[model samples]
Target: MITVSAPPPPPPPQPQPPAGHAAAPEPARGRRWPTVVTSLVLLALLMFAQSFRFPNDSAVTEPMVASGDASAAVDAGSFTVKVDEVRFAKAIGDGAEDSGLSDFAPETEYIEANGVWVVVFMEVTATEKQLTTFESRLDSGDENVYASTSWLYNTFGSVDDGFPPGIPIKGAAAFEVPEKALKDPVVQMTISSGPGQRLAGEAHVKLGLSGDELKKAIDGAEETLDVPAPEMQKV
Candidate 1:
């Protein structure tokens, strides 16, 4: 009998994809745009941090006696009497909102000297025109007596009652310095008839400082507050 028929021809080998056709591409390294951008950003931030620097504040000049005729008066020995530049500028606080320029014409403030506190107010023309005119009339004359409409002496008693009537005004009556407040240095002056009111007229005042020294302080303040005198209606 014949041997078993030969096994069927071997099945053809299965087809395989070409070497470069199907294998997953190797993961691209250092080619990521996002990663590169992120690295650059970090470097930039580091450089920026290194460049920053802080500023330092300068020292303040000490108070000095302003040179002038010792006997000069600022406002008839009432509001101001002397010129002490160092003291005048220092009267303004660091946090004060006003540039204090307006103070040159129709403004007032409180100050201290020789352990005394005083309020200072200058009554210039209350109107805008008067305010402008005042800027033109400031100067350093010894006998010049600029007439202030009214001036009041602030006292320690007023500190308690907030300035009662009977305070002296040169044009109206002889106002006396209360014995109780002889040593107190602060005084108040203003343009309004009352405290915290809009200025109705040109006026100014000084408090606390006193004597020849007080006069000198006001004169110094005048240098800072040299605005033209505002025109006043004739009586």
Candidate 2:
């Protein structure tokens, strides 16, 4: 009986799974945000290496009339002027160390003194030689030399002909005066003797308040030139 039972048991201890084959693999971990953050940092570094350097200096200077406190001037009375256009010219004088303003030129010159706005145009003339030199000299990096605006406590007037009187002519025109005019108001303009060099001619138009009439009109008003455009028309 024992022999028979042993024989049956020995038939087969069911094959046990080979060593580790039956063990399940551990659960895998998911992706983390640190990996994503690392990728973004790398991308940012690449983009930062790409950006413009600014220029060191500016050659042209803006005109003065455009600079001053327009608010104050507008507040004064009936202060209205419209500058439609402007002109310039260049000129040179013989044996002169500098052409002064003779090199500056303008194309048209006229003054429009209508309601609420005043515009002035003056002819300009400049020779070829003068212009060449002016161009070379205008290449400045300073605010003092080629500055565009000047102030006079009193009044500025043009002594030229063909100008009308009582038309509020007692004031300066905020026009562009070339380098020549900057040196001295009383300067000489001459012709140039060079190939392809032609005579320079032009006019300058300026805009500003008719200091004479505007000042007089404003003195009477409680709030003079300071009046706005809509209110100025009423005056």
Candidate 3:
């Protein structure tokens, strides 16, 4: 019977928003799809800019010269070349048996069965007036590379000695390679603009031997080959 009436039901709990505000409209549920799509587009563009930064061996941008017929003339950029002959021997003489070299030795001071000597006889003719040099190497079928021999001295003219324009010179390059590589070998000749400029205006010459031909050459008896003096002729 106190008749307080519960304090008029607490004034009906009036709304609490300030004077002129609409309560921020429930924070707008924010689309979210536009932001996610923009982030993915930016990531795709970044990956597209990184593809062309380096060289790949699988791409061949330059032309390669193919192997030519035996003793056939092939045209290089600065010169014309022909592989005249190839010989395999157990030992290479110091050219002493033929001439003034007699005071040196009868045979190479050493011999080994695990390896053999390869002599490449080539003729080169300069096509231009520029000073040019020649280099040679042997590539086995398995892609092993062997440089020409520096130990076995030869009286034959050196390709390193550059040639003059329109002049032809004949010489031999010797390589000491594993006996097993004697079969199906390819000889590569590189002509350069100068002794120091090995790649400038470079040209390549490739020569290969048939399987039967290489076997016969390797099975031959030991013999002494005289390094033929360089012969120069006008083109």
Candidate 4:
């Protein structure tokens, strides 16, 4: 009949961890799945980003171009040219026997065009040096490029020799091109020699030809275009 025996001695007190030792970690399962999923998501995002490619400046190698309309001056750093006039012809000749440079008579050298011959007269002046070389081309509306014919060499003012410093030199070049070229014709002039025009400054002039105007010029083109010898301009 004494009061109920005192509750069993208090359960033994739990022991404290030794100094500096960590308590046990939580079960790994709880954190493992979330960590793995986060890692996988990051990896997937990285892979997805790698799938696309972008364009940069390295892909462009075209020359720097100065563009203008016919009769306008287009300067290309190295030199400048003005499209003074444009003419069309079916055939062209020098009409002279002696060019002084050679005994070669250009009078008998009449060249017939497969399509139509376009003649361009330009006033050129060198900005960088008195010496410069030029190669000409036609960038046509039909996406065709026609190079200037060498047959006109010496017959017309030859820029082949280049222009003097400061003073403008008169010259002309001929290109045999399809009628479609006139639809949106552009004359491209490149400085020739050395590495050959790549990455260099180039001149482009829109000839202002298309539709009826183009047709009229083509239809009325001369049968045989003859011109006097090209002369150098005086300062």
Candidate 5:
């Protein structure tokens, strides 16, 4: 027998994976820390860079304020106002005596003050168009923000007093506050053309009636001060 059977052809070489296809060794648990640390450093750097910049202007939500003394004319964009006098009164009116109101009313109208009445006489003028509404607020270095009292509706000053363009409406805005509220009293007048008045122009009239001057006003308060009736004529 020619037992010369050709040596079985060497088994086909076992299929070999390409060099790039070799299974990658599992990464050491500690090896991931460098990548995590690098990511953290980048995030911290981003936050640090932001700290050097000033605050965004849009975040300033305070209204634009125009400040002046009692006699000075303060321009509040839509309207200009000039405060003439500030009076402290024990009572506003009595049906027998003058009510400080122009119109006469029956049934014995007497707007007596619980604390004291601070009347601010002012002339308001519209800059662009006729404005029918305005507002006043009192800041007396206290917790309470006193608004105009409704008790003096018939008095010269109305929250919605009409102001024509270029013309002035002379009236008085009244606030009833305690005698102690005289110190550092500031009255703010607000006018707006639209519905919302946020960031709008405001007039901060500094009545030189604080400190020693404040005491004088309290001492010289009228028994019954008369608030001139609101009229179109500028006084």
Candidate 6:
């Protein structure tokens, strides 16, 4: 009586889950499909991006071929230029037309050529009002390069000087190259940003001439050409 004996005769044992029926599995760990797919996609994109490479500037070849007499203009960033005419001669006289050898006495009056002389007439309009320099060369089909001789004598003043914006200056460039190299030629002009500066860009004017044209130039090589004066015009 004092111990209340037997208490409640040990409360009945708690019921256990039925065999083969497990307690609800912890909410199946969240499926990682979304995160896994996102990682795979990012990896694929990265691999694809690394497969391509940009071309090097040095590897770039010359631009499209342009005709010397083409109405289209050649743009060289700092200046826009056009080739007006192309002529050839055996010798170049002292800029003056009627001047005799005596007029240039003491100094050589004409520039004699070992082969033939190539003269290119060009018009250049400066995009910027600044001092700059231009270089020209004649490229032969045979891979020969003939530099312009316009600066050697007083023939045509150089386009490489101070230029006024929106004004075009017309001048001639001369080169002496072997006769065999004259078959098919191309004139190229390189522009410099300023004196002693590196070359900015180049403009190529192709001399698309037939065999007859080349023959005509060669036939007239004996005559002397008077260097024409440069004229200015509106850009």
lDDT: worst 10-residue window of model 1:
131-140
Error of 2 at 48 (Å): 43
- TM-scores, all models, native as reference: 0.18, 0.17, 0.60, 0.65, 0.65, 0.63
Assess each prediction's global lDDT (C-alpha) against the native: 0.30, 0.24, 0.62, 0.74, 0.74, 0.68
Model 1 / residue 133 / CA error / Å: 21
Over the stretch 92-152, how does candidate 3's per-residue lDDT look in tens digits? 6444444576566555454432477777777777777655555667776666888776554
Candidate 5 accuracy as TM-score = 0.65
Task: For residues 80-146, write the lDDT of model 1, one tens digit per residue.
Answer: 2232221332232112224566555344442322322122322222222111111111111222322
Which segments of model 5 are wrong by more than 4 Å?
Answer: 1-63, 94-108, 142-144, 155-159
Off by over 4 Å in 2: 1-78, 91-142, 145-156, 159-235
lDDT of 3 at 54: 41
**Residue lDDT tens for model 6, 155-190:** 343544545667888877788888877767888876
lDDT for model 2: 0.24
lDDT of 1 at 20: 71
Runs of candidate 6 exceeding 4 Å displacement? 1-71, 97-108, 150-160, 196-199
Q: What is the lDDT of residue 36 in candidate 3?
A: 74
In model 5, the number of clashes is 0
Residues 1-235 of candidate 2 have per-residue lDDT tens digits of 4554444445667777667754524221234566778889987876665422223322122111211122221111111222222222121111111237535633222222111111122221221112211110111112222322222111122221121211222222232333322221111111122222233221112123334543443233221111011111111
What lDDT tens digits, residue by residue, belong to model 5 across residues 32-111?
88999999999999999998765866536445788887768989787888888888888885223355652554544557
Residue 27's lDDT within candidate 5 is: 50
Scored against the true structure, residue 71 in model 6 reaches a CA lDDT of: 56
